[model samples]
Target: MRTLRRRMGLLVVPVLGLGLVGCCGSGERGSDASAAAAGFERAISTGDTAAVCAALAPESLSEVEESGKAECADAIPESRLPVGGSVRTVDVYGRQARVVLASDTLFLSQFTDGWKVVAAGCRLRAGHPYQCAVKGG
Candidate 1:
């Protein structure tokens, strides 16, 4: 019985070491995602369009630019100018992520840098574009 226990311990130790290595590698990726999300949030809070654009995926940035809006910074809504509240949560997967923010409204997306207010018209969605559904009537 003692010999059997020693064998099991040896097997378990190697397996646990491998698992730790795997976790460390994955953890690095997660940290990158978190950093990206934080950068995006800071840019939005400051209403710095250039910074925001820098944080966005290239394709999304081009789309906004092609719209012929003034400047990327100018496109931000007045209400969002003085950003308030905290980031409720951030969930990242690969190149995409969702950051739930605390505000009068809910912002959502599958942003490469994390969930962002690419569109502020409506609630959050995984794949669809943002739809501003604020009730103005």
Candidate 2:
């Protein structure tokens, strides 16, 4: 689809900083990372706050709770992070990944449990790490 191609283009452009470069891992790991991102988006779209919180990396969940001054389940939806879009690309490194979607970019980490989103609803800011609406970054 044209939309999918465009979104993939967005991933390649330097402005987004999510190009699939320097990847050095198995495709299976990349698939897992993408699946994790997809699940996170699905949770957000469904308003399953508990599921959303569960998909977040521990530190990110803690930050979300602290920012909201509420429990993670209560805070995740209140954060209003962008979610629910087709995955355009997934770049995986050692225990880390960047999942690019039509609406947002998510940074994830592989934990003992699985891949977890460490940052979501992210935007590149030239000289800094992607600034995220919900971040432990």
Candidate 3:
């Protein structure tokens, strides 16, 4: 039993390491993700409705539209998203990414065109996934 447990531990270590590496990703992907998050903040701050809606993922756009009963640009501005300040950290795994900002955290997914915000204005909750002001259903 001890030997079997040791072998299992060895197997788990490499898999876990890979997962961590994938989560951290490389500078290039991380940079892109960071840029996307920063762009969203800029658009929002500038009150550029088109750019703001363009930054959002399709599912998120749909949620805001359905819930607000208005266009993406109109609804998103009224969603009360927190001001996402400077990009602090960017983590990527496969097609998904999370950009942690000074005031907020944004979850993004890689789309055909580019990275889009799947969720934004997120705050960490103890023992739970992030609670986001902007997210799909």
Candidate 4:
């Protein structure tokens, strides 16, 4: 339990440098990114490990597995990620996107398959990269 809690803290404080700045509703890109982010959020909130793992980018999934020293299914449930509300904003730049919900922020990237989450449960810190609870190394 103590180790799990410590890992969660590490997740929250890790810096992710994605220099994205813009508003939501940029057309089809925004919609797709928002949809992917919403699906990830929903999966996490509902404790659907399969869906959650599927929604994650490969690197993000690997990071979670490595950090927790467990499989994605067991590790994700222990991360204690925030449950997001309705999509409030979505900013897409090229293939990268950020989706801001009522209570959470997520970063995603477009892949051949579709948009997959790169980071989740992120909080902004002035003059720094986002601090995320789930992200790639």
Q: Pick the winner on TM-score between candidates 1 and 3.
A: 3
TM-score of every prediction relative to native: 0.48, 0.81, 0.81, 0.82
Stretch of 10 with least lDDT, candidate 3 = 1-10
> Best-fitting candidate, measured by lDDT?
4
lDDT of each: 0.41, 0.76, 0.74, 0.78
Tens-place lDDT per residue, model 1, 1-25, is 0110113112111222222322331
> Candidate 3: how large is its RMSD?
9.4
lDDT of 4 at 85: 85
Better TM-score candidate (1, 2): 2
Q: Which stretches of candidate 4 lie over 4 Å from their true place?
A: 1-24
lDDT of 4 by residue, 1-137 (tens): 01111243433322232333443447898999988988888887788998999999998999899999999998998778899988988877677777889999887879999999888888877754467888876
Q: Candidate 3: where are CA atoms >4 Å away?
A: 1-22
**Residue 40 CA error for candidate 4 (Å)?**
0.9
Q: How accurate is candidate 4 locally (lDDT)?
A: 0.78
Candidate 4, run of 10 with poorest lDDT: 1-10
